[model samples]
Target: MKQTPERILLPVSPVFIAVSLFVAFLLNLQPWGHWVGVPDFVALVLVFWGIHQPRRVGIGIAFCMGLLMDVNDATLLGENALAYTLLSYFAITLHRRVLWFPLKKQVWYILFLLLSSQLVQMLVQFIISQRTSSWFYLLDSCIGALLWPVVTAILLAPQRRSVNTDLDSSL
Candidate 1:
């Protein structure tokens, strides 16, 4: 009989999560020039963590991150917080189903969640500014949705582990 190798899921450090959030914040702060349609990297990370580590990164954390985003971007105080909170809610609710599927399938879900977040932010902006946005404003969600697979793969790389052949024999 042939034995199949098992991979272990190592625990991610809290420091790693903090640093990832900070890096995403920096990414969100980049000057995209006319590319205001750039993906919301911070929101993407929030949604990802909400799905994969719901307990550790719940709505509170999402809201806090959103606040940071709002402050950094000089938008209304609760704008990003509301969007992130909503996104986190959806991500947590769908997490179980997401984990059961392959990453390819999860991409669709990620897109949906991201779009929803963008919608919330847009609504908040319209309410506050009392101005209608351009149809082109929706481009950010599309761009973000398209980036789901790449983002997921990058974030998941550290969690993926193959058995170390020499170390496996000692167990």
Candidate 2:
């Protein structure tokens, strides 16, 4: 039996991380964000970075991003901040375990994380508005989970090293 070699990933660039997060935030600001089944891009990206680069993208960044989301949405202050903070915390905590799983298996874990974040946001909204949102709101998390593999591929592209390296030359 032959074992497949694991591809070595280069160190992620801080600039790439920042750009990804910024793009996600912009996606969240789209008008379609309020539509059912529309995923929360910011939360998705946050979870991705939290799991893959916990040391660089942790709770503090999550909180700040959440606050920006709240301001943009004009929702009660701290609603998204609290949810995102918890999401990042949990993702960071489970980073090692998650990395051990294959991409397909990782979907289940990502689903749980995304669902929990949505639940927190829903609960906060309920508290502020005294109204219950339709159950379909959770669909966003499901969509986000389904997109996990694609997101991982896109986000990790910058860090993926070429399979063939020239030993004779140092770049």
TM-score of each: 0.86, 0.94
Candidate 1 structure quality by residue, lDDT tens digits, 18-73: 88888888888888722758888888888788887888889998889998888888
lDDT of 2 by residue, 98-155 (tens): 9998888999999999999989988888888887878999999999999999999999
Q: After superposition, how far is residue 154 of candidate 2 from its true place, in Å?
A: 0.3
On the 0 to 100 scale, the lDDT of residue 100 in model 1 is 77
Please state the error at residue 77 of candidate 2 in Å.
Answer: 0.8
lDDT of each: 0.81, 0.94
Model 1: lDDT to the true structure: 0.81
- Leading candidate by TM-score: 2
In the order shown, the candidates' Cα RMSDs to the true structure are: 3.6, 2.2
